[model samples]
Target: MSVAFIDSHMVEKFVENSQAFDKCIEERFNMLDMNQDGVLSRDELQNDANDSSFVELALQSKEEVDSLYDVLFEKFDTEKKGGLNRNEFGLLMKEVMLAKAHGFGETPVCVIFQEDSLLRRVV
Candidate 1:
């Protein structure tokens, strides 16, 4: 079908796809937000996920991921509030997906799942 032939409903289908993605993202954000304070700190981020050392996540060196948290915290915390909000968390998730999709690097199990499917399913 031509783009002109499509209607609002067709476009809405794409919007609807994001519902699941938003849910998943929110769930993850909640998981990361241990205090229910609606944001992530360096210590909070480091402790979540598996029992593995900080190095196990995203397959990066402890120095890399550790440093990344500092960078990520600075970057994602656009408000400079010292933590990541849900939107910021989603951005981080997208970054992980894109990096893995392009074979740029490895990721943690939570992020390593069928990323393409998750990305498309999200939006």
Candidate 2:
């Protein structure tokens, strides 16, 4: 019923192995490749429909998805220049997978950036 519980259950159902997980990552990479240039940009990531699919899987709504993106774009904008590099995007994906494994429900995967940071502070 909780995000964590949903995340764990989904991971169990969908991410049974490393290959499966890699496939998910690859799918995400392809989605984020908005320009088809084989690279990802902050605008592409922020506006990606593929990114939305993960949130939809996690069962979040459009407004929630938007808010989540706002937070991720803010944090991953490491240079405060307003965008994420591939490395930052990869880190975000890693955290999402970890959260899924840990059974965290999805407000949105992007929300994980803020939630994880806050959770770490609390812990």
Candidate 3:
């Protein structure tokens, strides 16, 4: 992991550059597609999702965590299908990044992001 200073402005600039943002999203989606298939199954997403200390820190209890995941999965599965296609994954990622950016608004935070992490790539 590497420490980086990040804030809303920097993230907003990255998102505003559509070409770069799309490229980054594509890269991240590909990485998350664990079975080498173009579609991402709920299981695939949950595999990586299990390690989110950030979410655990914010939520008060296990029930909250489970409920949040359920809600998120339902939201991401826009087609009502069991899996997320590239476009759906892209949309979900864009929203997630933007939300993160909004949370960091005007406040620079020191974060330790994994080398291959999306946040690290964004920075």
Give lDDT tens digits, candidate 2, residues 46-119: 56544434456257676876788788877775766565655666667667656655755543232233232212
Error of 3 at 19 (Å): 1.5
1 versus 2: better lDDT goes to: 1
Best of the two (1, 2) by TM-score: 1
Clashing pairs in 3: none
Runs of candidate 3 with Cα error greater than 4 angstroms are 52-63
Question: Estimated TM-score per prediction?
Answer: 0.60, 0.47, 0.83
Greater TM-score among 1 and 3 belongs to: 3
Question: What are the runs in model 1 whose C-alpha is more than 4 Å off?
Answer: 1-16, 49-62, 104-123
The TM-score that candidate 2 achieves is 0.47
The Cα error of candidate 3 at residue 105, in Å, is 1.4
Tens digit per residue, CA lDDT, model 1, 1-123: 111122333333433456765686787677778789888877777776333322357577778777877888777788898878888887776666555444522231223223323333422
Clashing pairs for predicted structure model 1, backbone only: none
